[model samples]
Target: MDAVFVIKLSALGDLVQADGALRDIREHHRHAIITVMTTPPYLRYMQRCPWVDLVFVDPRASRFNLVALSVLRRRLHKQHIDLVYDLQQVGRTRFYKRWLFPNGSWVGDVPGCSCYLKRPKGAAAADHFAHHLRQAGVSVCHTLVGNVGWMADDVTSLMRQAELQPGFVLLIPGASAEHQEKRWPHFAELARHLLDRGYRVVTVPGPADLAVCRAIPGDMLVPDDGYYDLFVLAGLAAQARFVVGNDTGPTHIAAHLRKPGLALFGGHVSALSTGLQHTCFSWLEADDLHKLPFAKVWQQVEQLMGKDF
Candidate 1:
């Protein structure tokens, strides 16, 4: 059996976006042993994915740390990988290509590699993944239409535990802590509007988002342990009638789940570049989120909800 390694590191949104490419890779190399190298945070989440055979954690130690680098090298040597796909085409991956897998058959942005995936200028992330996979002899049907259905657990019990019905609107009012500007300031107001319209509103907060998410007027969904992990969040997103969130991981998951949703974007990033916008999952971009009035978003929500609400 052929040994294949795919390297994709941090950021939950990026991981969620790569689901299509990952599934395509699995189909293309059906007989190969595919292993995905990701960070510790996503180890368990990726393990739940049916596309890959194995999931490995990369500590992401500095290049200067010879001991850690040597350990990583030793681990790679043990696998005898026949091919490598560096999905995370960053400086660290480039270094790994140059030093660790110097003579290996590699695919990505590295110079003189077996297959170099040169991203087209102004291409969206999903489009780029499709283009690269096509170059690697893999058909790219699912690259843009990624699904997270496999990642969803049985959330029925949890829904009853939270006293949520089947048709609640999911409000993800938080973004990455570092990018506070991406978060629209009117989610609380939006929640009020949704509630007043006789819609059941619920919010799922990650570990860091509790304080901000709780401030929004809605049913806060949490596990028995008082924490909502990625898997549980995926389950909730799959069941949500409509999702409204900032450009964050849960929003990406909800978008990939093919839920009718809206992803709010600010000056930090465009919805086009992120590829979070789908047929059902629309996006509204504002140059400055703070200045974005609640009325405009509500109008979009009304349109998004249609006669269902």
Candidate 2:
């Protein structure tokens, strides 16, 4: 393929999960000019992505807007895209297939496309990514081993400025606003114990999480001026000795980076479905997070520490 397009948009955690899939695509089509059609929230990160050669903002405006659709069609046609990988695999992307690239070479769940790979109901995201790629004749090594090594920025100066050092235990005490139940209520208590044990606790909160994170006892890693971007968040997780957090985007980054950590989850989703757990990255699930106590989570932390305590 001379030109290719991969569709993935929105939500920070899902984008991080697609790291492995993106790498596999780039490696398989090394000679092709690969582009990612994403939303504005992820435009900056996609521009820095090592795998894709181009990034296009999918306006994702109302499908009924003829002017917007016309502009998108014209731009995509200019690329002369030879193949499209619809990783998004949602209603919006299916609409794109039917409207913009009606007959062009397309690969995804959409029926009647050049290549159709249906995701099994209730299949894990990582597994589904690998399955479809292998079905499409691409080697599927990295899709199951999500890696964000390339997405990190050097935080030496930032670390110094923040009066923190590497190897400190990282704590993520907040979840997305809509999923407040996902936030375990014991981080403050847990941080106190870590502090007593002489472990430096650190937290890097997103814009929406500053208030919640600041209340937790830790060396808060925020820009003195504005905010922390994806690279810096990955960098913090990359350098952390151990991570303890709710199931949020930063915790997913920690897991994929192969950091030794504990991700707490409620009954909303299973850890297996997210595929974020590993030998080093462990999880503890409860039917209700509010009832999950700090003692149990602390025990998991001690276990992650490998009897060094």
Candidate 3:
């Protein structure tokens, strides 16, 4: 194919998981112009991906916007794409085949496609994703590609301004607000413990995390208006001695970069699918984030770091 398009428009964690598929696509068509369609929030990070050559941001104006779909159709038609990889095998993407971009070699569950992935019964999400690529004739391998470097200079600038050194511990204390169960309660305490142990703990706080940020000890570093985008976070994380985070996007970024850390997953998330496949990473969890005490998580962090903190 001269031109290939991939669609995975939302959910930051899932987008990170699609790294392997993107890598497979790159390997499958080395010279093809690979474009990805994603939501506005993820476009910047997706643009950072080395496999994709271009990015299309879906405004997602509203639910079922026919006008927007028409504009999108016209826009995609301009690309003369030879293949469309629907990584998001949902009803919305199915609509793209049934309605908008109706004529194309789309590799998805939809009919009239070059290939289809009949998801194996009881397959894990990661397995299902990989299976989809393999069924679509793309070579699936264990390569990850999440590198936009959107703020390399900014990360360095901000770190230098803060007088922060490398090897500090990064703590991500927030999760999707809709899933309150995913937010762990002991991060502040963990920060305290790490601070007492002489490890600098830093966290970039969202508005939802202000309370958690304030609850931590004064020693913990919280960036003021740093605008820590994914690449910047990845850059800082790359230098960190350890990263501890809730099962959220940054945790996935850390996992993608294979950072040694503890991903605190609650019972709500499937560890097998979302857990970092790299051995350097580990996870600790309980029935819920509220129930998962600090000690259990600390033990896992120690194990990940290969020493007592």
Candidate 4:
């Protein structure tokens, strides 16, 4: 089987987007082996996804590390990888492509600000990458492919351990980095309102956002390190009556899973970057979720939960 290597290292949302590109490869070249190289944390996410036949983990070392580069090169050579798709398209990705497959074609974002302008509105990041793939002779459906298969068994076990019950509202109160801006003031009020409404508000915070969860008063369910995998998180999201969060990875994952969700977006992140098509709602800057009263969010949550009131 001829192999193609897709390199996308970190950031869960970006990695999730790569799943679409992988789907494109599979749809177009069913016989070819499609492998992805990402960070270790994302391995479990990729493991359960059927689009990828193999996964390679890039080490923690700097991309400029000669030893690491040599190892990566040797691995690609051993696998007889015919093509390299640099989804990341960072300086390191360019370096890796130059060393490993100097003669191979590299497909990724065009240079500079042009990349941002190329992305279409309401299109998921994966759709943007798939468009680039088409230019490279790989044709794929324009539709976005969501995450594959349920880690239901894993999620059930985690929920059991946490004593989480059905009809609980899942609240994710943080984003990965500082600039992302978590709408905590709104979330705090939202959490209290949901708790009052007879729904258990479970707070799931990533490592960086633990402080936000700690601030939410009441018994909250935070995933132990064991269930940190995105797929497992998606399964957990599926179990929720509704998910409320900022424009973060887990929120995107929840939306991708078609979980009833309300994504609160401050002026920073747009609906085009994070909104999901199905029952998902986006509170954009124009809507101003941060400034809106908790009652508004509660009303949206009620609508998603099918509560007539």
Candidate 5:
């Protein structure tokens, strides 16, 4: 294979959850140039991706701008893409498959395509995604183990400034802006519960999380500014005795780091479908995000923390 192209644009959480599929691609095409078409928001994470070779930022106005779409078509044609993997498998990439790379070999949900992973009756999204790739001829296991190169020096410096210790528990109380329902309102209570149990609590705020952090009533080291780096955040999560968070990128990433974590979810989405795949991690879901009582969440956190608590 000269070059393989993958389309997974926008939604950092979706990208993060697609770890297993990426692993399959990397393992299958070790010598092939692997490229990904993603959005500007995901550039930082995609830059450090060990699996992908080229990271193409999708032209913002391509959907309606014929000129922009033409430019993209010319670029793909020049590259002579050997295979196209439509991981997003949504309307936009479907457009690309139809108009831009009409003759390209594809492995995705585009109808009549040679390969499509049939999700079983109750398969998790990660597992189903991997199964699709595997059934389509890529030998990939369903499990995902994310390998992130943490920024140790930056985390150390920041931890020192915040007086954060090794046993601190990281609390992630944020979700995608559109899914703030996934942001549990009781996180502050959970933080206080942990603090009262003789553990320090730290909150990592994403762009949509600062307001949530500000509403807390206790002493918490919310990032003042210029402290939002996923690399450092990964390092901090890796050090925590236990991590708890809503189903957000940082929370999912924290669990991906293989830390002892509890990813609390609401009924809006399935925990099995979107949560982490670590044996050390546990998923708790309720009918509604707001209905998840603080006491039950605290219990799960303690279960994960145990001796550390």
Candidate 6:
């Protein structure tokens, strides 16, 4: 393939899954130029990833905006895209594909899964997208590249500024608006456990996660304007010995980056949402968590910490 286009718009976790697919594509077709079409909020993340050759920000105007659509159509034609991967697969994105690349080979969803409020099964979105690619003749497994090399420098600088110590744990306790149910109150309790165990704790929150960040103990270090960049946030996560979080985008990033961690699921989303990768990690159901005492969580943490991971 000379060039390919991947369309995955918003929502952090799904976007990260798209990145994994992009990595596999690059690995398989080293000479192909890969372009990713995503929303502005995720443009920065896609730009920093080495697997992608270009990052096209989805137009700010509505998909129905004819003028903006015309401009995009012209741009795609100029780029000479040979194949299109529609990871988003919404009706609007499908419309854009029809308009922009009438003859390009299309791969991905017809319209991806709705949010958990619709209560879809917990399958990893990356695997789901990969299945589509396979049906279109792209042979690859769903593997996570995580965030590496993308923000190595920024993470090092931030760690120096924060004076981070070894054996620190990262606590992420936020999710997007649609995934709020997946987040639990146990992050604070987990932080306390790590602290009492003589480990420093670093908490990172997105722009809207201030309330969750504030709930962390005062002793724990929360990034002060440092995590504005997604790559840097991933790097910070990499520096930690392990990460503990609800099923959110950063948790997936940590998993991809090879950071040993535990992902707490509320049963609102399924294990399918996160590819069932076997490693030094644990997945706990929200109801199961409610039943288990605090000691069980600590035990799981210790068990994970003891492994090679």
Q: Which candidate is the best by TM-score?
A: 1
Compose the digit string of candidate 5's lDDT tens values, residues 1-309.
Answer: 679988888676778777767878888888999999898988877877877998988866658888888888888787778988888877887788788877778887777676755456545657667667767788865335554433222478777887777878788888878886787888878877776877787776766777887775444554666456777778888778888888887777776666778888888777777646533679889888898888888777777677646
Query: Model 4 residue 308 lDDT?
Result: 41
Tens-digit lDDT string for candidate 4 (179-200): 5455635677777777776777
Q: Show model 5 residue runs off by greater than 4 Å.
A: 60-62, 118-123, 141-143, 149-154, 217-219, 222-224, 275-279
TM-score of 3: 0.88
Candidate 6 has a TM-score of 0.82
Q: Which stretches of candidate 3 lie over 4 Å from their true place?
A: 61-64, 120-125, 143-154, 218-226
Write the residue-wise lDDT of candidate 6 on 1-309 in tens digits: 588777878877776656667777777677888888888888777787788889888765677688887887787788788777676766677677556655556664433311111113455566565565565556665343433435444566656777885557888788886766766766678777767777888886777677888888623344554445566677777678888877787787777666788888775666555663633456666554445456667778888887542
Residue pairs clashing, model 6: 116-119, 122-270, 122-272, 122-273, 123-272, 123-273, 124-272, 124-273
- Which is the winner by TM-score between candidate 2 and candidate 3? 2
Evaluation by lDDT, superior candidate among 5 and 6: 5
What do the candidate models score in CA lDDT, each in turn?
A: 0.87, 0.87, 0.74, 0.67, 0.75, 0.68
RMSD of each: 1.3, 1.5, 2.7, 4.1, 2.4, 4.8
Total backbone collisions for each predicted model: 0, 0, 1, 0, 0, 8
lDDT by residue for model 3 (95-174), tens: 77777666778888786667777555444546776767777676767433333233233467767877888888988888
Clash list (residue pairs), candidate 3: 48-148
Better of 1 and 5 by TM-score: 1
RMSD of 1: 1.3
Q: Which of the two candidates, 3 or 4, achieves a greater TM-score against the reference?
A: 3
Which candidate, 3 or 6, has the higher lDDT? 3
Clashing pairs in 2: none
Weakest 10 consecutive residues of candidate 6 by summed lDDT: 111-120
Query: What is the per-residue lDDT of model 2 for residues 182-221, given as tens digits with 9 covering 90 to 100?
Result: 9898888889899999989998888778997788897887
Cα deviation of 21, candidate 1, in Å: 0.4
